[model samples]
Target: MARAFIGLGSNLAQPAAQIQAALHAMTQLADTQLIAQSSLYGSKPMGPQDQPDYVNAVVALQTSLTPHQLLDALQRIELEHGRVRKAERWGPRTLDLDILLFDDLQFSDERLTIPHYGMRQREFVIYPLLEIAPQLVLPDGTPLSDLQHTCDVNGLIRLSAQ
Candidate 1:
């Protein structure tokens, strides 16, 4: 199995509820095991600050799925939750699942990028990530804790956990 980290977030229509629902759906994926999850963190929206605050968390999982397969699954979950990628980048959404890291794999394709291009630049992603895996490193060995310090997010706070 391949170990992976997924960043979860929601900012519309009961944000916390959507995150919990997505987690449940993830658990149901065949050949995928939800390993450890970080405590929830609330933070101001990263882009277009005019939107609602977001509830974010990180989940570590063991999955037999390939990178593309995992991406497909995440997109399905978003669709189930009524996610609409209309306008306003970083605008509010029902559910947003990002593949933060998939083992040490690295790739940049037209559709996706592993070790997510922005994982090292978001406090909302790094804070909860540090909670569950502080020593977690990218292929380049950058520590999660160190990355949290440089993100420019506002008002990041722990909310709850599973």
Candidate 2:
């Protein structure tokens, strides 16, 4: 099985409940096991400030599914929770599931990117990620803890334990 990390976020329709429900849905994916999850963290919206703040967390999974398969399952969960795609980037949503890392794999395609495209730059992503995998290193071998210090985490706050 491949060990992977997924970032979860929601800023609409009871954000905490949405993230909790998504965690449950993740455990039900075919051939996937939810190994661990970080506590929830609240952060300001990355895009337009007009929207609500986001609740974010990271989950670790062990799955027999390939990267694309996992991505498809995540998107399905988002849809089940009433997510809708919009032209505005990082807009508020009912659910947002991103593939942060998939077994040290460095890959990019039109559909997905492992070690997610902007993971390193976002404190909302980095802090929760650190909670679950403190020793994690990027595909290029940079330690996650080090990266955590470099991220701008001014508005990030721990909300509750998962």
Candidate 3:
């Protein structure tokens, strides 16, 4: 089984609850085990300021599924939680599930990218990711703790211990 890290976020319809529910749904994924999860974090929206702040967290999973299969399952969970795709980039949503890292794999395609395209720049993603895996290093061998320091966490807040 390959170990994977998933980033979860929500800014609509009770953000914290949406993230919690998504965590629950993750446990039910076929051939996947929810190994660990970070605490909830509140952060300013990355796109438009008109939307509510997002609640974000990171989850570690051990799965027999391939990267594409895991991505498909994550998309399914987002759809189940009422996510809708629109033209607006980084817009508010009911759920957002991203494949942050999959083992030590580095991949990119029209559909998805491992290590997530903008993860290093977002404190919302980095902070929670650090909480779960403090010593994590990217596939390229860059330490996550070092990346955590490079991010600007001005508006990030930890909401819960779990």
Model 3's alpha-carbon lDDT is: 0.94
lDDT at 160, model 1: 86
Off by over 4 Å in 2: none
Cα deviation in Å at residue 76, candidate 1? 0.2
Residue pair clashes in candidate 3: 39-162
Number of backbone clashes in candidate 3 = 1
Which window of ten consecutive residues has the lowest lDDT sum in model 2? Answer: 147-156
**Whole-model lDDT, model 2:** 0.94
Clashing residue pairs in candidate 2 (N, C-alpha, C atoms within 3 angstroms): none
**What tens-digit string does per-residue lDDT give for candidate 2 at 1-162?**
999999999999999999999999998899999999999999999868999999999999999999999999999999999999998898999999999999989999899988799999999889998998999889999999999778989699999986
Model 3 TM-score, 2 decimals: 0.98
In the range 40-118, model 1's lDDT, one tens digit per residue, is 8898887687889999999999999999999999999999999998867788899999999999998889888998988
Per-model clash counts, in order, read 0, 0, 1
Q: How much is 147 displaced in model 2, in angstroms? A: 0.6
